[model samples]
Target: MIKLIGILIVVIGFILKIDTLFTVLLAGVATGIVAGLDFNQIFTILGDSFVSNRGVSLFILTLPVIGVLERYGLKQRAVSLIEKLKRLTTGKVLTIYMIARQIAGALSIRMSGHPQFVRPLVNPMAQAAGLSNSDELKESDEEAIKALSAASENYGNFYGQNLFAGSSGVLLIASTLTQFGYNVTGLNIVKASTIMAVIALVVATIQFTLYDKKLNKSHKK
Candidate 1:
């Protein structure tokens, strides 16, 4: 059907590596025209869809603010703050953050996350800690530290959130089990989640300790 022309346009545009937003908008407009909709109708449809899913665009609002903060030395300040703590190491910093993240998530206090917290603050601080006693960090080593910081947030959130009584994960588990003919309760899910979180914390602590040892040995050489 001619109406399916938009799908072909999207596939071609992506394969050609065109700008994603422009490609989608062009495809949508073309599809509307082929379906006998005028420009006004097409524009109205686009506006309504955007309004319904505006939450996805929420991150755009934060980018400018983050850029302004960076321009004002936000990352440098984070690094400087970490450098003042002579005994902190990259592994120790991330491990502490992981624990704090897990605890906060369990309490349903998700004020810290990758974009809002880790990128703007945690990654820089962790990098500074790694570079504190060393001559310089290799590009690979810097990237590894950033990767670990991001992983810490993910690990903490995954295992921790279910501990909250009203967490969506608990509901999903209960709902899924019910669908499968199991009468699982929220309290049971919370109990299981809490146990899993404890195990995760222990494993994370051990990994961090080993990583710290490795970093120290490398710095000494």
Candidate 2:
């Protein structure tokens, strides 16, 4: 039970607004010591874990490039492009991106949205479209717009990935069903996933539309 201090450490670190990476590393070292691991053993385990999941860090490489592009006004370009389409409301922008993301997922094309696209491109575009008026936004409205921008990426990624026949989620489902003596194929899972994806898209579209209405309502009051 004392070994569970790692979780406690994370909670305290976050509450105190510590550097996230340093806090996690400290927590890890503390947990290792409590578990009777020598310093060398703890370092070795950390190294092994890092190596095993290094693929996740690959995105970090894109950060410098993204930063450079943003420094050159990439986000401004995106905002300008979206603003040109007079009919493109904030909700419409999100809906369109969600649709594109879903289609890309169906084709097994990876779109690393949050940092590469959403933060640098989509969020700014949404903010521009969301402004839609000369009036400033209430803090809640601003937060909602940001949340919706992120949610659009999440919705598309989660529901869209399942549509691919070769996606890990589809394969896992087929394999798990086969283990339970139920014959299933990735293609079959994907077929069903397509319907679910459509349903999810519909739901997201409705939410986006309503959010737009809410924004308009807020501004009117």
Candidate 3:
């Protein structure tokens, strides 16, 4: 019963619009105290969790760098580069990025496309390509294109990461199955992940192509 205090604290703190990091830490400390844990022990657990999920920490560094780049015309540069390629439509640009992202994931390369690429590069490229074929881009069209651009990164990362034998997802799946008395290995998960990634790529390719045709038709009307 006492251990559930953390959830209550978080809910209340969030509702009050409190400082997020401070609220969470306060909740942790309160919960630890109630659960008979000393401050040192509670901090030890938090520190361990932080260390294990270092990816989240890297974003702290990457975000400011990305912000600095954006301030200096990173997005403008991407749009300008894409505008020079007269034939590449919005869908085609997104498709190419999706494929590249999938391959990077499969090879165990860590690429956080939303922050590192999509927001600053792919989305602008897509908008430029959209403008090339349309007389005037509507608000609805812009929003739709943004959704599709974001989805491309999600599809690639979600389906392709497990293709790596050492991916956390693969290991988790294998371990969970083994706990249930099944004999599954990370290699087995990787094999299945490959098939899923292929299917996803094929499906995404069709979707992007169809979108281009539809978008072109609508613009011509």
Candidate 4:
């Protein structure tokens, strides 16, 4: 279909690095026009999306604060603290942090255990624990590894958070659904989240265990 082709064009154009964001926006507008929407309606849709996801803009402020905190020694503190614990393995430390991250999220605390924390802190600590040489990791590989670590934190947090009685996001969703004549309850959502979080924890633990075994074998070689 023409619409599907248009969607693929947007995806391929971005992948090809062909001025993607601007091009996609323009192409999307053109698609809307073809779908019988006027230019004014298209603009209104864009405006609505931007306004609805305004929380995204908070990233601009949050990033700078995270950067400043790192500059002031957050990374150093995390690594040094981990280093002092001689009994800890890299995988163990990450696994423990994963637990802590999930617990914090469940309590509705949006703690970002990401690049600022994990890369400069957790990954290096992990490498030190694993006795890994930085040179052994290709830049892309390192980035990928760090990205995985970051992603795990997000998963842990998202799934863990809302285990509490009053997570704002959970409440907001429940309230909105109720208003729309859906009988969703906060406790119901929280209970489902707890089940999902347990499943994810089991799965993630298995993955890390396998990865640790591979790293151990590599270290022996």
Candidate 5:
């Protein structure tokens, strides 16, 4: 019961905007002790997990860089560049950005859109698409657009990344399949990845077509 309370405390604390890492660590320590982990062992596990994921902390580097870039109007330039292309709609503009970002990720170039770049470009472009100037969006419309944007990015990476021989997932998949008596090789996996990429591209094309129609209606309004 005490261990369960610790877990509840950690979860509730985070949801309530309390210090999350401390809460979670405290809960974990309590749970580990309850489960008979000695203090040393608990610390060791914690250290291992922390060290293993330390690279994720590098994301912090982006925030200041984005802020500096945005202050200089990088995002404005991105938006303005697209705006000048009178044929581009908000959805189309965002779609292109998503595709390009994903492709970069697959190639291990690793890029992201956010407060520094996305808000300056995507948000304004969408506004230009004839959405009400009001700052609010209908929940349904927001959800739909968000889903489309997420899907575009995910599909781009999914279809492109596996092409690399060095991709860990390719090796993992091949190994797992071999265990199941499948005779898959690295080359075969690459071919399969190519096929999947083609499928994803087709789906993206269809979505773009639909979004184009929506943009037309928006412009007409």
Candidate 6:
């Protein structure tokens, strides 16, 4: 069908590495034209869609605030706090944070997050632990430490959120299964999520141990 021309345009535009927003807009215009819509109609549709989904841009508001905080030595304070705890290695600190993050998520506390928590606090603390343990870390090692900190937050949130009694994910799962005539319940979903959370915690602990060993080995060389 000629209407499918938009799909082809999308594939071609992506293959050409065109700007994503431009590609999508162009494809939408082409599709609208092929479907017999005029320029005003297409523009109106795009405007309406943008207005409907404007909440997605709410994060933009936090950028300047985060920048101001970073300029005020937010990272330095986090590192200083971690430095006082002499026994906490990078891996141990991240592992402990991961556990706390998971527990918080399960309780629906929603306290830990990437932009609000990780960048401003968790990352600096983790980096400080690494610096405290070693004379100096290579740039690559420092980057890896930051990546691990972010990953720990993500892992904990993903596996633990489902354990919340009335989490959206659990409701969605129950609703979808019920639609297919399956008798899945919210309680069962919570139980399964708890089991998964426990498994993830075990795996995370082992991973942290291995990561610490690797860091120690690198420092020895």
Q: Which candidate has the highest TM-score of all?
A: 3
Better of 3 and 5 by lDDT: 3
- Pairs of colliding residues, candidate 2: none
**lDDT tens string, model 4, 5-33?**
56877877888889967867877787777
TM-score of each: 0.74, 0.74, 0.78, 0.59, 0.61, 0.71
Over 4 Å off, model 6:
1-59
Candidate 4 deviation (Cα RMSD): 7.4
Q: Of the candidates numbered 3 and 5, which has the greater TM-score value? A: 3
The best candidate in terms of lDDT: 3
Candidate 5 lDDT over 1-221, as tens digits, reads 76576778787888888887888888888888888889999999999999999978778887887778879987577656655666665466556765675466456665554544455555556544424332344565556665565566566666777776557878898999999999998778878887777677777867866875764555456
Q: Looking at candidate 3, what is the lDDT of residue 101?
A: 88
lDDT of each residue in 8-53, candidate 6, tens digit only: 9899999999998999999999999999999999999999999999
Worst 10-residue lDDT window, candidate 5: 127-136
The pairs that clash in candidate 4 are: 105-161, 106-160, 106-161
The regions of model 4 sitting more than 4 angstroms off are 1-65, 132-144, 172-183
Judged by lDDT against the true structure, how good is candidate 3?
A: 0.90
Q: Which regions of candidate 2 deviate over 4 angstroms?
A: 1-57
- Model 1, position 179: C-alpha lDDT score: 97
Task: List, in order, the clash count of every candidate structure.
Answer: 0, 0, 0, 3, 0, 0
Rank candidates by TM-score, best first.
Answer: 3, 1, 2, 6, 5, 4
Residue 35 of candidate 6: its Cα lDDT?
A: 99
What value of lDDT does candidate 4 attain over all alpha carbons?
A: 0.72
What ranges in model 5 sit over 4 Å off? 1-52, 64-75, 112-120, 126-147
Q: Where's the lowest-lDDT run of ten residues in candidate 2?
A: 133-142
